[model samples]
Target: VGNDTEPYKTQKYYGQSAFPSSAQTLTVLYNDHFKPEITTSFETGFEIRMFKNRLTADATVYESVTKNQIIDIPMDFSTGYSGAVLNGGKVRNRGIELTLGGKIIDGDNFKWNATTNWSRNWNKVMELPEGIDGQQIIGTGGTASIIAKVGGTTSAIYGFGFVRSPEGQIVYDNAGLPAYPEEIQYIGDASPKWKAGLTNSFSIGNFTMNVTIDGQYGGIIYSQTHHKLSEQGKLNSNNMGRETGFIIGEGVVQNADGSYSPNTKQVKTADWYTRYYRRANIESNSFDASFGKLREISLQYNLPKRWLKNTGLQSLQFSIFGRDLATVSDFPIYDPETAALNGDTILPGIEMGQMPSPATYGFNLSLTL
Candidate 1:
């Protein structure tokens, strides 16, 4: 069920009109409203085909729940007013999907084919409205801001880190670093827990080949392209270097019979006017949960039906392709799939030279008449 209504008008005058009959103004203000929403979903799946059928498989699982949720909420303009749409809230999403097909060989002059797919997603915000416990929903790519929040959990990573301590802990800054708190650091969970794809094909007699691969797992990427390439140093000009020294482990700060100190005035610094910029480079460079091969291998040819059998042109084909190409990851810098969940700030994932992810060797042609 769903419904909605919106209308607005305004005009007010109390000063300056020098006489239109001593000027005094007021115009009709109209506002009408209605909102309705309700949704529920559940899905199940199955599929299988074997051997003779050339083998095929499929699987699925899904869940969705949404209610009310018409958010616009956020207004206190010092009492100025202009912000309203409310409807409490609720959101939930659960998932699983898998697919596979095969035909390793069909033989008739030689043939082979393959396919694969995978997906998994989970999102939740359950409810919100009432003093707003923590609200934010993904942002970062250069200033749409946000960066995570909203019932959080999934290993959160919203942006601008280190500033905890309301019992949350993580505040430090006498010089030992880590102590940002002007605001920012939505913290954790950049999405992606699983996603995958694979493809393969081959042909003989006319010659053809194709291969593909893709992956994304566990999620969490806030490298802001190595924090804007380590703040302009250009991150060693893409060599991406950073390990500047001074993060002496865990909340750091010892000696009182705890040992570990190399005189920097007996050490204990960390607080350069709120622990260095961009919240300590987003809590010390974040990266993990990877598995990218993204794109790969392709080759093709097909043109020989007795050279298209007298121009009737039955078939013809050609191919070549490449992209982003390769990545395994220990992540020293660059490649984290160039990170972007979508918060569009001129294409986020700011790493400076900022335009990697290109490796195309393109060529394609197809004709059949």
Candidate 2:
């Protein structure tokens, strides 16, 4: 369990002293408030051994919940303030982990061993006080966007879906395409269902080797950067550019004679630009919600014991590893592991030439007295 508190105070006033016969202070205000939160978590697991202790395994599952989450909600400055912090919502998470180790073969001259670990997590929004529903809980890292709701899971992205008519029917354009408005729709979320990992090691006749792999599956990532770049004509490779038609279609606000009409037409590229990009900051598009294998593969080897012994060294080893080694998507950009879902940072999963995570190849030595 955990708890937190914040305090704030405010004062607002208008003043005029001596300003070249002009007025100065329109509005002066100082404000502050206090907010507190608490969190609790629990986990349970087990360990077991078999085959005369040659094989060992362990598994664990955990659940965590937090309440009174404080956030700096943006304010309408027209009301005379920039923003304020409030205790608004709650979140919950649950996961399971499994690890195994086994001596495939053991003997004085040769031995073989293997080890693996796997895990899966589920997150949801447990509650939201009044006036705040269907919000998105974006992360601080890459471009991941999670959704928020009462009883909804964590790392979910919640926003407006395509607009529907008053009768709850999808509006279609003359082109027969579903007209998506430049405005966002609270249609779906971007959260993974699970993640997993594995590792193995072996030794035989004075030589040893090890390998490791890890991955995450069943999640979604929103690439705001890609959206912006694509709109600016930067990401020519992004085929989504061909999608200039609006889901809400188009409509004339006023007739040439100053009258309005319900006959809206298909939105054009100009409308798409003004509505989706210029105004909304280009974050509404570029969402990849697919299951994928994040990364896998690693290898290492130890120097022969006899060679190390003769060199007066206790041990010596070398290794090489690669990340984002493979992907199952047709995404033309780089790896999709660039996004995160938590706070209002930028979008994640948009792979710019930002420094790619390094894959290391090196060696090490250890000596014991």
Candidate 3:
């Protein structure tokens, strides 16, 4: 509410082992005018069951607007401080969610149930604090960054891209390399367009089974992993023209008369791969981050009451399950669902050498007396 200060001390040693202590201050300054963030929201939903509890549905639509967002804004060097924490901006979010559940089979000793959930959200930056205009940097990931721009999604990514001709064709340089703008441009949004999940459960006699699947549709990610692998020739596509010693670039080139022509320059095999997949070339590494995953599958068995009566026990259950078993997507790398990690923060739409998602398998046993 007030300020942040670190009681830091340093020691200065003299020639003859005499030491003096000096106090140090941090680079961040706390603003006295900062206030707590406030959010005003409205939500409406309905839950109903039809056909005598055999089918159920839940629907919700909500809108929320947040004001006075707490943020750190960079300060001028003359201030002797790096940044200041202030109440900065406003953001709006609108979304809808739907969930449906059904009891497909209802019989003695045998039963089955299925459920599905779907949700979609739209996020926009309504306004920025006074003095800041156009856009503000929210997070950074290597050569790319997350930005909150007015009228745009909150998780918009800004990065460099290839310079193209009027016809929207990539314009290559005489060296057969792609050309980029002098400044960063809007790439894409990291927020997924929609998400959905399905779950199925079945029980027959003393045995039960469950299966779950989930997926995210739409959104893009700048993958440093893909570029690093391609640059090092670790990817299979990098093998092109390796034996032939040279690779031909594919793009249009500006001619002498201000017109365009097909590029025919042949670059060295090593040079083509290195420059084409360079870390700063965001266009080549960015990919659609949509994917469907086999989230989980499990089977369980319970001891029958007739058998448990002799053991002086009330109930017992044993189950085995597997999680993150598989994925379906056009993503070139290990997992499409990834985010850039900075200290304790995780920023989406940019991947920097993310570890593969784990596949877990285990069993469980339960008992009661």
Candidate 4:
């Protein structure tokens, strides 16, 4: 919870002419009657060791409740204010985490230790402010947003999507273009279903090496960067049709008598891609946020005490390390671990103008007296 006033931020995008007033625009509104948001949490955990303390396990379960959540109040664009900040309502989250470790090999000159951790979390909007109709927009990028809906997860993407039939088939119109839902709806959850990590350490002859890997299993993100890139034919995915100059849309088109027919109309490639990958086409622009990465690796050599005895140093060690060295993800423009920035607020799930994932490598030395 915070009682201090928040800072105002606006990123003026001059070159983009897609949206109405893309040059410099107003995004958020200030409110006078602001209340601090508060969250209360409870947790229970345990630690256990077995087999002469060579094997260990730790587990915890937690529940949290948040009230007066500071969120955005939806406003009409005609009013000149895209959204206003206010104290929304209640939310709940529950999760559990477990970690296990064991010594795979134990010896005087050689040893191996491994550990793994896994966690799962679920959240729900318990209540909403009056007149919100059970859902409230919390963050926005382009035309899509992160929203909190009653009985839904707090991190949900709200946007327009391609209209589909009962069997999960894309619906196309007479123009051979995909149709869309007139009403905005919840498209996907931004929160990951589960996350896991693994670490291993090896020691031999006064030398030690450690490796760590981590991953997020489930989630989705709406990326405006991907949309813009695809529309501009900068992506390999949208470049194929350019050579042929045109492409036919794949779906069933509605006929005059209301029957559906296979769409064979060859729409211009440029027009097809631009409309398909536009920012407002949230569902088409969103993708799975799942990713796996080699989080870190390090190697260290510790000088033997017998050799250090003659030197002034009591202990000495040298280490080489690398972090975020590698990653495997389906995200197009940057890392899947991206979020939307609206003013001073950081909202997860939507991506726009975020930086790429970074990697670091370095060497270090330690001396003990």
TM-score of predicted model 2?
0.65
lDDT against the true structure, per candidate, is 0.59, 0.55, 0.85, 0.83
Instruction: Put down candidate 2 lDDT per residue, 224-326, tens digits, no spaces.
Output: 5555565564665533425654434334233466444453555554445444433223134544544354353445566667776667777776656555555
Candidate 4 to truth, TM: 0.86
Off by over 4 Å in 1: 1-44, 50-52, 55-57, 62-93, 102-105, 125-150, 159-181, 201-212, 217-220, 224-229, 232-325, 328-369
Estimated TM-score for each candidate:
0.35, 0.65, 0.92, 0.86
Off by over 4 Å in 3: 1-20, 310-312
Which lDDT tens digits does candidate 3 get at residues 1-369?
Answer: 232322221222222223456445556665655466788899999999999999999999999988888777788979987876667688999999999999999999899999999999999898987767577888888898898888987799888887889998888888987765788888888888999999999999999999999999999999999988998888876778878999887888999999999989998888888887788888788989899999999999998888887797899999999999999998888898888887777899899988888999999999998
Candidate 1 residue-pair clash tally: 21
lDDT (10s digit) by residue, model 1, range 1-369: 454433332223343466675653323222233346566889999999987779899999999877776555445666454444555567778899999989988999888889999988888777765555467342345432442245553235555565554445454444555544586555445566788888888888778777887877765555655654444445443221234323332353334674443323212122222233342456555666466785878788887788777797889898777766777765556566654545333323323333556667788898989
TM-score leaderboard ranking: 3, 4, 2, 1
- Candidate 3: 10-residue stretch with minimal lDDT: 5-14
By lDDT, the best candidate is 3
Whole-model lDDT, model 1: 0.59
Rank the models by lDDT, top first: 3, 4, 1, 2
